[model samples]
Target chain A: MKTTITILLTVAIMAVGQAAVAEPVKIGMITTLSTKAGYLGEEIRDGFQLAIEQEGGTLGGIPVELLVEDDGRKPEKGIQIAERFRTRDGAKIFTGIVFSNVAMAVVPKLVREDVVYLSANAGPSKLAGDGCSPNYFSVSYQNDNLDEVVGQYVSDAGHKNVYLLAPNYPAGKDHLAGFKRYYDGEIVAEVYTKLGQADYAAEIAAIRAAEPEAVFFFLPGGMGINFLKQYAQAGLNETIPVYGPAFSFDERILGAVGAAALGVKNGSQWTHDLDNPANIQFVEAFRAKYGRTPTLYASQGYDTARLIGSGLAAVGGDLSDLEPFKAALSAADFDSVRGNFAFGANRHPIQDLYIREVVQTEDGTFTNQTLEKVFSNHVDAYAESCPQ
Target chain B: MLFFVEQSLNGLQLGITLFLMSAGLTLVFGIMRVINLAHGSFYMIGAYCGATTMAATGSFLLAIGAALIGAALAGMVVEVLVLRVLYRREHLDQVLATFGLILFCNELTRIIWGRQPLFMDVPPWLGGSIELLPGLIYPIYRLAVIGVGVAVALFLWFLFSRTRLGMQIRAGAENREMIGALGVNIRLLYTLVFGLGAMLAGLAGVMAGPIMAVESGMGEDILILTFVVIVIGGIGSIRGAVVGALLVGVVDTMGRVFLPSLFRIVFSNAYADSVAASLASMAIYLLMAAILIWRPRGLFPAHS
Candidate 1:
C-alpha cells in the first residue's frame, strides 16, 4: 500500500512539473491606455485579445501571457514600461503602441536589448527607413504609406489644384510630403494648423477661398471630428469633396462624425468590407466582442498578434534561436486581414492599399466600403534607405 | 480685401465663443472670491449634456436647455458638497481641491461617454452660410454666435448695474462679511451665483458643441484660453472679459491666417511656415504680455 501511494504521488508531481514547463509565453504590451488617446490603445488591445481568444487563448500552439501597460501617451513612460517588461518580466516579445512618438522612444531600447518588437499601430518613418532593425517588425503600414497611396489615387483621378491641411508637426509634415510625392498637380494652398486646434472656421474659410478641386487633411482624433463637423456645417461637403488617409476617416471616427463623414474617400490597407477570410473573421469577432466595428488601428493590432503567432510557431516556440526566429518573422506567413500581406526589406507591411469610401450600411451605420485597390502589394519608398 | 473680411468674421466668431466662456469665469471669481479651477469641467459637462440630448431628442433647443440645466445643477451640487467647505480656506487649498475635481470629472466623463468624441450637428435652420461679402461667404451659425454673445453681454451689463441681486453681488465682491451681516443669506447667494456662472459656461459649451468636438478634456484646452482672456480683461470684470476675448480672438485668428504669409515675405515658404506657426500660437501670449506691460491691473479692474 505504501509503495502504491508513493508511485501515485510521483505521477502527480511529474504532471505538475510538466504543466509548469509548458506555461504560457509572455509578451509585453506597452500602449496608451489613458486619456483621449486611450480609445485607440483600447481598440488595439481588444483586437489583439480577440485574435488570442480566437486561437483559444494560445499563440503558435503555446498558451500566451500578455502583460499590458499604459503609457499615458508619454514617450518616457513608454520607455519605463518597456524597461520593466524587459528586465523584471523577462518578456522577449513586445507589441502594441498607439502613438508614433511613443513608439519611436520605446522601440530602439527594446530592439537593442534583443527583444522582438512587433509594432501594432505606429509606423514611424525613421524605423521604416535608415534606422530599421532586424528584430523590429511592424504589422502596420508605414506612416507615409497610406498617404502615398492616396496621393497616387488623387493624381490618377486628375484632381487639379488640391488644398492641403495638416497640423504643424512631424507626422503632419510627413503626410503632406507623402502626398506631394505622387501628386504632380499644383497645390493651391498648404496650411498647417496648430496641433489640437479645436476651431477650424478660419481654416475652412481659407479652404473655401482657395477653391481647390479637393481638400486633403491629416487631422486625427478629435481634431478630425471637429474639422469634419465644421466642414459639413460650412456646406463644403456637398460641393468640395474631402480626401484623407484612413487615420482621419476610420470606423471609430466615422461613427463619431456621423453623416458628415459620408462620401469621404480615404486610402487604407484594411476596411470592414474586405472580401478576405481573415478580415471577415476578425471584423465579425471584433464586433461581437467589442460591440463596435474594428478600426484600422484594431486591424493592425490583430495582425501584429497573428504575425507573432506565425513567427512563434515557425520557431517551434523558441525565440532563443535568433536567426530562425527572425527568419520566421521575415517569412510573413500569416494570412493578413488586409489580404496580400508581405513585408518590405525594411520589415514594414507591403500590402494592398484600397481607396475606401465612407458609406452608410443597410442599418444606417456609417462604415468604410472598399471602392477599389489603389496599390497591389505596395512597398514603401523608404526601403532603399533601410540596410536590413 | 475679401480675404481680410472673411478672416475678420472668423475672428469675431472665435471671440464670441471665448467671451461666453470668460464671462462665467470672471463673474464667478468676482462675486465668490473662490478660485474655481474646475470651472472647465462644467463646460465639458455642458457640452456632453447638450450633445447627448441632441442625439437622443433631435431638438437643438432642447439640447441647449439640457446643457444649461445640467451644468447649473452639477455646479450647485459641487458647491454644496465641496466648494461650501473650501470657501474660507486658502486659495492654494481651493486650487488643489478643484484640480483634483478636474481629474475626477474627466474620469467620470470617460466612464459615462466612453473615449470617442460625440458629435453635435448644426441645426438645419442655422446650417446655411450667408454671403457676408459678394465673393466671401460665412456660416450663419457663426453670425448667430456673435449675436448671442452681444445679447448676453448686454444682459450681463444690466444684471450688474440695474438689478437688486446685481447690487448684492457687487456688494458681496466688495465685502463678503458685510453682505452676510446685511441680512443676505450668504450661502444661498453663493450657491445661486455659482449656478449662474455654471449656466453661462454651459451656454458656451452648447454654443461650441456644433463647431468643436464634444469630448472629455475639451473644456481644459479652451479653459486655458479663457483664463488668458480674463487676465487680459482684468480678473473678475465681465466688461474686461468681453474686450479681452475679442482682442485675443481676433489677434489669434488673424495671426494664424496671415503670419505664414507675412513671414514668407522674408523667408522661404517652408521656413516661414514653421516659424510663423510657432509665433501664431504664441501671439495671444505676446498680446497678454504687452497688455500687462501697458496696464498692470488689466484693461478694466472691477475694484477700480
Candidate 2:
C-alpha cells in the first residue's frame, strides 16, 4: 500500500512540472495610464488585448502573458517600470509607450540591454534617424508622417497661403517642419502657443488678421478640443477651412468637440472604414469587445501585437535565442490592419497615408471617414539618416 | 486700428474670466487664513457638475445652478470635516492637507467621469459670433462671459459693502477672535464664507466649460494664474484681486498677440516667433516682479 501511494504522488508531481515547462512568454507594456491623456493608453491597451482575445488567450498559437504598468505620463516613472519589468518579471520582449518623451527615455536603454522592443506608438524622429536599433522596431508611423501627408494634401488642394499653429515643443516644431517639406506655399503665420493652453482667443484673432487661405494646427488631446470648439465659436470654420493630423480628430476627441470637428480634413494611416480584411475584422472585433470604435492608436497597438506574435511563432515560442526572433520581426511577416504596411530600412512604418474627414454616422456618433489616399507607400524622410 | 480693438476686446474677455477666479481665492485666504491649494478642486468640481448637468438636462441655466450648489456644498462639507480641525494649525499643515485634497478630488473625478473629458457646448442662444467692428468678428459666448463677470463683481461689491452679513464677514476677516466675542458664530461664518468662495469658483468653472476641456486637473492651470492675481493685487483685498486679475489677463493676452510681430522687426521670423512665444508666457511674471519691486505688499494692502 505504501509503494502504490508513492507512485501516485510521483505521477502528480511530474504532470505539474511538465506544465511549468510550457510557461507563456512575458510581454511588458509600459504606457501612460493616468493623466489627462490617459485615454490614449487605454485605447492602445484595449486594442492589444483584443488581438490576444481573438487568438483565444494566446498569440500565434503560443500562450503569452501581457504585463501592463502605468507610467503616469512621466519619463522617470517609465524608467522605473521598465527596470522592474526587466529584473523582477524577467520579461524579454517589451511594447507599449504612448508619449514620445517617455519612449525616448525608456526605449534606448531597453534595446541596449539586448531585449527586443516593439513600439506601439511614439515614433520619435531620433529613433527613426540616428538612434535606430536592430533590437527596436516601430510598428507605428514616424512622428512626422501624418503631418507630411497633410502638408502634401494642402499643397495639392491649391491653398496658396496657410497659417500654422502648434504648441511650443519639439514635436510641434517637427510637425511644422514635416508640413513645410511638402507644402509649396506662402506661410502667412506660424504661431506656437504655450503647451496645454486652454484659450485661443488672441491667436484666433491673429489668424483672422493674417487672413490665411487655410489653417493647420497640431494641438493634441484636450488642447485640440478647445481649439476646435473655439475656432467654430469664432465663426472662422465657415470662411477658412482647418486642417490637422489624426491626433486632433480621433474618435474620442470628436465626441468632445461635437459638431465643431465635422468636415475638418485630417491625415491618418488607418481608419475603421479601411477596406481590408484584417482591418475590418479588427474594427468589428474591437467594437464587439470594447463597445466603441477604435482610434488610430488602437490600430497601432493591434499591429504591434500581431507583429510580435509573428516573431514569436517564427521562433516556435522559444526566446532562448533572440537573433532569429529579431530576423523574423525584420522580415515583416504579418497581416497589418493598415493595408500595404511594411517596415522601412530603419524599421519604421512604410505605408499609405489617407485624408479622413470628420463625419457623423447614421447612429449619430462622430468618427472619421476615409476621404482619399494622400500618399502611397510613403517612407519617413529620416530613413536615409539611419545606417541600417 | 480695427486689429487693435479686436485684440483689446480679447484681452478684456480674458481679464474678466481671471477676475472671477481670483475673487474667490482671495476671499478664502483673507477670511479663513487658510491657504487652500484645493481651491482649484472646487473649480474642477463645479465644471464636472455643470458639464454633467448640461449633458443630462440640456438646460444651461440648470447647469449653472447645479454647479453653484454642488461646489458650495463641497466647500462647506470640507470646512466642517477636515478644515475646521486645521484652522488653528500651521499654514504648512493646511497646505499639505489641501494639496492632498486636490489629488483626492482629481482622482475622484476621474473615477466618476472616466478619463475621457466631458463636452459642454455653448447654449444655442449664445453660439454664433457677432460683428464687433468692420472686419472684426467675436464670439457672443465670450461677450456673455464678460457680462457675467461684470455683474458678479457688482453683486460681490454689494454683498460685501451694503449688506449687514457683509459687514460681519469683513469684521471676521479683520479680527476673527473679536467677531466671535461679539456673539457671531465664528465656525458657521467660516463655513458660510468658504461656501460663498467655492460658489464663485464654480461660476468661473461653468462659464469656462464651453471654452475649455472639462476634465480632471482642469482647475490647476487656472489656479496658478489666480494665485498670481491674488499676490499681485494683495492677499486679502477684493479690490486688489480685481485690479490684479485684469492686469495679468491683459498683459498675457497682448503679449501673446503682439510680441512675436514686434520681435520680427529685429530677428528672423522663425527665431522671433519662438523667442517671443517664450517671452510672452513670461510677460505676466515679469509684470508681477516689477510690481513687487515697487509695492511689496501688492497694489492694495487690505490689512493696513
TM-score of chain B of each: 0.98, 0.98
Task: List candidate 1 segments past 4 Å from native.
Answer: A1-12
- C-alpha RMSD values across all candidates: 2.1, 2.3
In angstroms, give how far residue A364 of model 1 lies from its true place.
1.9
Candidate lDDT values, in order: 0.88, 0.92
- Model 2 lDDT per residue over A127-172, tens place: 9999999888999889989999999999999999999999999999
Once superposed on the true structure, which residue ranges of model 2 sit more than 4 Å away at CA? A1-16
Score residue B262 of candidate 1 by CA lDDT. 93
Model 1 C-alpha lDDT per residue in residues B1-304, reported as the tens digit of each score: 9989988988988999899888988988888878898989999999999999999999999999999999999999999999999988999999999999988998899999998888788888998888876977788998988998899999999998999999998898999899999999988988998998889898999999988878888888888899999999999999899999999999999999899889999998778877888899999999999999999889998887
A78 in model 2: Cα distance from truth in Å? 0.4
Q: Which pairs clash (backbone N, Cα, C closer than 3 Å) in model 2?
A: none
Best by TM-score: 2
Query: Best by DockQ, which number?
Result: 2
Native-referenced DockQ of model 1: 0.70
